[model samples]
Target: MYQTTSKKTPWIFCKDIINHPQKAMAWVWGYISCKHSMMYTLFVYTLLLILVLLYYVNHRESEPNHDETFKAKVQQSFIKFVEENMPKRDQNKETRAVYSMRTMSSNGSLLEDEHAKILKQRAGDIQREYIGFKNKKPFNFHCDKCAVVASSGQLLHSNSGQEIDNATCVIRMNNAPTIHYEKDVGARTDIRLVCFRSIDFMNKDTLMIGKARFDKMVIWGMENPKHKKIKETFTSKFIRKYPGVDYYSLSNSGEKKATRLYEEYLGMDRLKSNSWLSTGWFTMLFAVNMCDSITVYGLPDGNQCSAGSKKSILYHYYEKRYDECWMYNQHETRMKTGHRYLTEKAVFKQWAQMFNISFKAPAWNLTNVNASEPIKSPFISKMEKIGKKRTKR
Candidate 1:
């Protein structure tokens, strides 16, 4: 039905010979090239838009983010707050806290000379094994903001990576890894407090996750320093396991301090759970001395643990629900086993109110317009009110 000139149309000239192969081939090739050109155009425009968006996000010309601004303002407040509680006259900032003695006021002064001596010797030996051991020196750093990252599962999908990374210093608890979980909890580690229980649980290869990854480590020891030689030997083994990292002996001094403090303040009335403060408690103690405005992420404030949700609740990011959450709750329900967690929660709430310290978890609080502070657990207040009523009666 169609006619073509053989001289002008290349396909027409070859129609009899090749059955219009040239024209058919030309049309197919032309269509493909046109489509490819359209795709290329679209790709170029998309790339340009992406570049503009990146420049806008990465550019620092705009005002600082709200969190950044708030943290900056809190810096002056932090220095002043710490100064009031821990005096420079009594506590030197440069004092090598490894040997720093606590004022036995909170806990009765009770360490015997032999126990104190064993603790000192243990600390010296452990320091000698670390990468860099300084004698009688205070921590050689300061930060405007510090983040104490707790391993509570509430951090699961928090999307707090950017905020956590922004801290001047970040202290992580236990053997919690940030590898796959960096989105919820950022991958910054200024210091990590290693629990004695996790010593065997940690791998030598995992410990080799690069020195550049962190600044230093503080190894928490046994709850009670009463074992003398066993404490020293156990602590020495713990340090020897991680030969390459630079770490401090939070072992004896802290153990001795906790013995007095918890006994006098938290223990005497006496559930066995009353004995040792969790490593998180010790970490907070460290932060109080070093940081200004401490914001703890996931320390289990005892607010959201409902009976219906208890089964699904995870106590730690490192443990499975069946493995840890239930066991932890089960232990709490029994006497003398759990670490006075409810009391600890009460103390933390008081501390948060007294100190400028705040909590961040179940992330919506930050993004929501109405919520400024962490929601207080109604149960905690009710318990306090009942205690007050009993006291009045």
Candidate 2:
């Protein structure tokens, strides 16, 4: 009886609960809470570690190693190649002839009384404009850098006017009429070089070409006597207003001297007889004479429709394309002359590289021909700023 009472006692019951039931439940709850806290801490630590690794990688990539030896070697090699391959200016009789031809072609009748009078007047104006700039202590022409810009019809779409304007002096050639005056021509051009064969070809704002018309209706009213007089009057007023501007006259007479000047000095030759004037010759001659750094934009890459193309008959940009009727005996003429035309444009490119003068074509596609590296213009900086702002948005 005493033993049975001990088993049901309150003390016995308390001991059992402490040893097993309530104690075991408390221990399990404490262990589970600690495990959960440790797991959460580990997860957050791993996430922070991954983020730091990504940041470090990105920062490393952003840095440029300007001191890299490979880059220096490449630049040295390029400079050496250019120095070796380029043609140095020849101080010989051939060079003399080249210069005389270029001067005579651009400035008409070197010994003529009218030519002398015009040159004397222009010389005085040039002196007056440059005198102040030359009198400074350092005697530097401040921003005398000149740029020649050529359009190969490819620049019709690219907005390159702002870049062109950055030049102190800009030279253009032929019938390069820009539809956007303020943005394209007016903004950039400090000087307009026109190769007018006749006074009749001159228009007030642009050089008018008779063959450029697509249809009869386009040039229908241009033939009128009143139109001609109005054009002449407008041109006279425009020139009078801009007296500082110079005008160059080329002969339409198609002489051999002109052809030689076009070929030897200017680096252009006829692909076929009776073809149009070479646009390449015009740009090269002007660049060599007037500008230090030349950037040609719109000139053909020799693959596309150039000034020498057969379709030039429709547009007398230089002159009429050779006519079949003009060739009397095809076999005899062909056999004798062979191909007088320049078949490769690499010759011009070679000359450009040799001079250490930068030549670039911005609108040319690199898919077909080996591409040239474009020199970064000031305009690119402005564009990059715009691009960054856009990316942020």
Candidate 3:
């Protein structure tokens, strides 16, 4: 027996909601008015959804930074701020930046300890010896006067060999030969400064090395992985072959300081200028430090560029190739990857005025240069200050 009740069934309500929206809405409103429980359940669910959305927003806002790019930018900004605001106390870690000439009224010689700092000697390391090989002791030799002979073509037929040989010490650069050119370049070779690349020339036997050729050899190169590996490989082979010849290497730090000198005093950025420093540059520095008086031969001075007489001379005395002035002009004016030969010579000119340095075999006329003028480098000027203070004491 079928019985009819006044309450709407679930099936009828669902059908009405699907087929008739107006009737469904009216029935829903009527049900809500009649039943408070259904209204409360809907309100509770809506409130819970709103709360869940709020919680999600808050959780996202509280999360820590995990972005690598954002972190890198923050780190860079902090480093920049520190560098800009802080005063540097350690010269060893000073910025590798090009500084223009700054005048200071002080004069001083580089102290031995300061020299060691520049060299950046390591613990248990010999100051001067064949590096990477056991030595009896550090190299302990000095000369009151030194003659730094150049490989320039200016020495050709100059007949200055005897005068060069007369010096207390003689320094040669790279793999320059004295076998046949001894009459013009001198026969004595006390020290030979070789860049690592010159090792290839030596291996080719184009440049000679032995106890009979030179008393000691100093190999130096810029600080780089390739240069380092080449230096190590060359050192091993050289020591194995010439066991008796004295050998030493200029430290990476020492090379760095030399590059800095070019930047600070000469206003030439080695990196930016793409300038490969000539062996003459290192030879001059060694002479300044090790010799009381230095006489450089066969090298041009600052005035060579402007002087009309130098155009006919060849680039190398051994070879009759490129013209001296033409080579200098090309290298000096090159947009990239060339030695700053003229610029280096000009700085050498300034050094002549400052130190006990003299030029010969195409002598420099530095009579116009003022000796009392301030040195071009702040580091050098600080050294001068120290010298002044020592004099006062």
> Residue 127 in candidate 2 has what lDDT?
22
Sort all candidates by TM-score, best to worst: 3, 1, 2
> Model 3 — which ten-residue stretch has the worst lDDT?
98-107
- Cα shift from native, residue 193, model 1 (Å): 1.1
Model 1 C-alpha lDDT per residue in residues 151-211, reported as the tens digit of each score: 8777887788779989999989777887778888888888877666665554445543663
Model 2 — which ten-residue stretch has the worst lDDT?
212-221
Query: TM-scores of all models?
Result: 0.53, 0.36, 0.61
Expressed as tens digits, the lDDT of each residue in 127-236 for candidate 3 is 34224234644445668999999878889889988999899999998877887887789888888888878876655333444433666777777234657778677767
Which digits, one per residue and each the tens of the lDDT, describe model 2 over residues 1-393? 455432223345335534664463453444345555676445445544665687689987887765565544543443343233212223444443344422332333333344324323432332222111112221112224555555443344356667766766665554455444324432444433333333334443343222221110001112234456644653466446433333322222222433443343232233322233444444454344344455655443443333234532112222345432222123112322322223223334533443323544433333322112211212223223433454456
Output candidate 3 Cα RMSD: 19.5
- Give the candidate order by descending lDDT: 3, 1, 2
Whole-model lDDT values for every prediction = 0.54, 0.38, 0.63
Which candidate leads the pack in TM-score? Answer: 3
lDDT, model 3, position 351 = 68
> Where does candidate 1 clash, by residue pair?
94-138, 272-336, 273-336
